[model samples]
Target: MASELPMEEIVRRGARTNFEGLRESSFVPLFLTLWGRQASDDHVRQQLKRHYESVTDHLVGVYADFFESQGWDPRPPFTIRDFAVTLTALVEGLTVRWAVDPDAVPLEMRSVQSSMRVERQDDLDAGPWDLFGIVVLALIPSMTVPRIKRDSELWADHEDVRGLVRRLRETWESMVGLSPPAEAPDHTAPESADHCGAEPRRT
Candidate 1:
């Protein structure tokens, strides 16, 4: 049956169909799907550090596909590090008033010390910057990043996307807010002070 229809046609058909029962779908199947495709999935419990060294590309592709599949089109024009900053801003934006206080969203995780320095055994060397490069590995999966400018046609046409991201953000905002504000995009890479040492972007 699967072979009877072309893959793209099947996906389009699914898009048009009125199938039900997917509202409460779990994420395990999806994550396992990406991991299954990459033989070097070190996220497996107790993976040695060396395993990550060989699978960086696999991980990045897995995450990139995850984001694109979620309709986060028109990606930012910056390095993965910059993209991380933008993504963080988007996911953690919107400072709402606390349920009781008239001042602002209570900084629940801001004051009491919420592991300032999380140590990952593998640099797998992934850093905070990896957030932009790898959305799939977020502590929680999301379809959008808050605060980041989503393009002109967005604010009006993408209410569903906006609502999804807004709620995802609000849900997490009380827990741990987004890092940097979506003020502006950074064009240069931090390590590019020596641009004389590298090549240029094709675009």
Candidate 2:
């Protein structure tokens, strides 16, 4: 059912789901701490590795579908698999920070006006959600623009690329002016099962 949604919708839903789970459980943090200290333990390391691999594989498939639906080719130099791995790494790094200090890390989804508070680096009270927005904005253009340019079908002329760049710039500017939201959006809403193609079964 989830596989039928647009890429943006899927990502939003997944993030909401993850935030809810993390809020309800301390297990993820405890496991990460233990894994960091017990890196030499083959059994524990293998379990963690397997989990990451599974997530990466799932993301790759999702991204491949997304790119295809956008009229973009999922080929080398900017492959869906590589993008998934990078995205997974980004999320894991953010999770580590959240685990260390949940309050300081903003993972919710409310109006930016409610949570734009900032503090010094030493104070460690910076708005992480704002940081996330900046990082994502920077990453999307750097990653996708080149790929879109490489494919003639995706980019008909200079105007097309320029239009994308202009939109990106506008979004970045707007994001810079806002802060992270305080509450997460509802993730319990039902999604359609209208698969664009054969949906892969998740493990």
Candidate 3:
């Protein structure tokens, strides 16, 4: 099914779902213990490795789809594959951490206390943000960059059109946690015409 949710929302939901499972599931630790014991048997260890690798492969595909949907590319610092691996490892580590010290890793953010304001009932039930969601949102900007379509033909030469495009690009960059550089890029430069409009977006 196609998701109408924005990239940030998708990341938030995915992270929270993982956090919920890690925190609430009773069988996870038991399964981990059983899986650990199987590591002593070479044949079982190989099978387990294959299973985990398959799961990682699935996560990679999910990330690929997410990036495509967002018109984003993996930034220079890391590849999409690297992100999938890191996220998987993070979940594993966080699962152990949560089990050991639930107090340290809370499921939701602490409520703000304001003496002047009365709490709304909806606010309590909304469940808008979580620690896992916050962490994922913070990492997204570093992990990916928006695909800026710079071909002159794709953009009209009119000042109004150009200004609108620039604003849109700025908004996109900001959404991904990027700060505008000291100098703005000259999108109209003739030498920069890359025939980008004709080419498929890079993942």
The candidate that wins on lDDT is 3
| RMSD of every prediction | 20.4, 21.9, 15.3
Q: Compared to the true structure, candidate 3 yields what TM-score?
A: 0.58
Candidate topping TM-score: 3
Order of candidate numbers by TM-score, starting with the best: 3, 2, 1
What is the C-alpha lDDT profile of model 2 across 87-116, one tens digit per residue?
666655666787678776676434552444
Candidate 1: lDDT over CA atoms? 0.36
> What stretches of model 1 exceed 4 Å from their correct place?
1-50, 73-138, 141-203
**Tens-place lDDT digits, model 3, residues 90-168:** 7767777878897777776655223212244543333455666777776775566667644643232233334545766
Q: List candidate 2 stretches off by more than 4 Å.
A: 1-14, 22-27, 74-76, 108-134, 145-203
The window of 10 residues in a row where model 1 has the poorest summed lDDT is: 15-24
Tens-digit lDDT string for candidate 1 (1-203): 22333322333233222111121235334533555655665455224224333344443454455445544432223233333434333322311122234244322223322332334443222112211112222322233343444554333333544455565566676678655356686666466545667667676
What local distance difference test score does each model get?
0.36, 0.56, 0.67
Winner by lDDT between candidate 2 and candidate 1:
2
